[model samples]
Target: MIKFGLLWHKISLYASLLWHKISFCGIKFGLKLNISLLWKIWDYCNQATFNEVVYHQRTISSFLKVVFKEVDSNFAKLGTTNNSWFDYLILRRIGVETRAAPPPSMIEVHWWPPVGPWMKVNTDGSALGAPGSIAAGRVYRDHRGWVRGCFHFKRGLGFAFETELLAVIYVITIAHHKDWRHLWLEADLAYVVRLLNSHSLDIPWRFLASWKWTLRLLQDLRLQVSHIYREGNNVADLMVNRDCSEGWWPYALDEIKHAVALDMSTYSIIRIKY
Candidate 1:
């Protein structure tokens, strides 16, 4: 009886979620994105949740401020708007009437595919030791989760940023070579994504020439870059841990094959946090 009651409760909750989804239209991220936000609203009901509301509002504002400020700083550094900086800002005016956003919540996440004509690349880079042996890896997949390609490279005596930045540059190079003009680049490093989106000149001087070339190539292609937490980037992370000195895999490696299959089946990996 208890289990039956719990099932019914979930059904009712989902029904409400569906209704709200149909009614709300602020963010176009779709049902999956809003699910956790709505779930967070009622996860722990009481004064504590209200307190969290205040905390999260401040956190979101600060995060947005920092990201925008960084971009603005980059714009100043470049002193030009013609460069590709991924200008993205959807400003919504807050009227006297408003909706309350809920605090954060744990959610299931998975490898999401790009729409048709757009290929995706998930990448990661790590150093054995800071300023030590560093390597990077990337996996290209289509909307059907078809393994388009897998590549990685090793470098001796370099900082982690070298691998991370190189990972981005290499993926762009691949896209151009393959004529995949529509590209979606995903990386585990938020900072790396920010650098690309900001078009910052703060990169290492050694890569400045290569970075400029990539930026120019970006103009000729439709490209997007995003950040995913390390967990969701399992395929690329696994690629980095292997000896890729042999170079491009004819197919997905055995270890990461299961993950690629799960993505093809639209499987979600659950994440729980305190």
Candidate 2:
């Protein structure tokens, strides 16, 4: 009988050192192998090494899988017409073609009046402490840059998203009251826009009744919904939570007056996307 005692790592040596992949076989014996050989075969993160792990999925099998995957990726990137036997095997198993990254984009945005006979409504919400006192507002304007009417409401404690949804419902209710069927609605909150376009079940239970009523009123109107960045929607931001819920057009707030003038003149603001 061969002297197994002569072998440095008896457990790994018993595998007869699979000549084609000795390194791969060595990692399979990590649990009982010598510490020096185990160190070379497997890697451990800070959390896994000193035992600070919140992720409990780390194991010898997973480490070997990760190592082989990274090797497969590097060989795939080479994209050489004539690949070696190992490279060919890896590419065939991965079964994917390399692709180039898409280029970045830069866009310029500005508030534009609704075309033809349509009216424009911009709405926004604010909460000083997010979960603290909440308020919301909406402004109405026409193609001629004339303010028909506007309302700002300060309500009981609520989250900002709730305030945003409430603001949309408020605008819808008022639009029905005023019999404004042809309207273009805009908001700074993308969530509000998405909510309007999705099923009512997507909202919180507290807002379900209001959401249903809003959607019902919307069915009777020619409402066009869209999203605007806060920069372009600053007019609504400035008017929110005034002394009273009722506001009229006469250049009362100087900042709002300037913003309306800028939008009317078709001045643009550059929006950068990284």
Please give the RMSD to the true structure for each candidate, in Å.
18.1, 12.6
lDDT of each: 0.68, 0.65
Give the Å shift of residue 239 in candidate 2: 1.3
User: Which candidate achieves the best lDDT against the true structure?
Assistant: 1
C-alpha RMSD of candidate 2? 12.6
- TM agreement with the true structure for every prediction: 0.60, 0.59
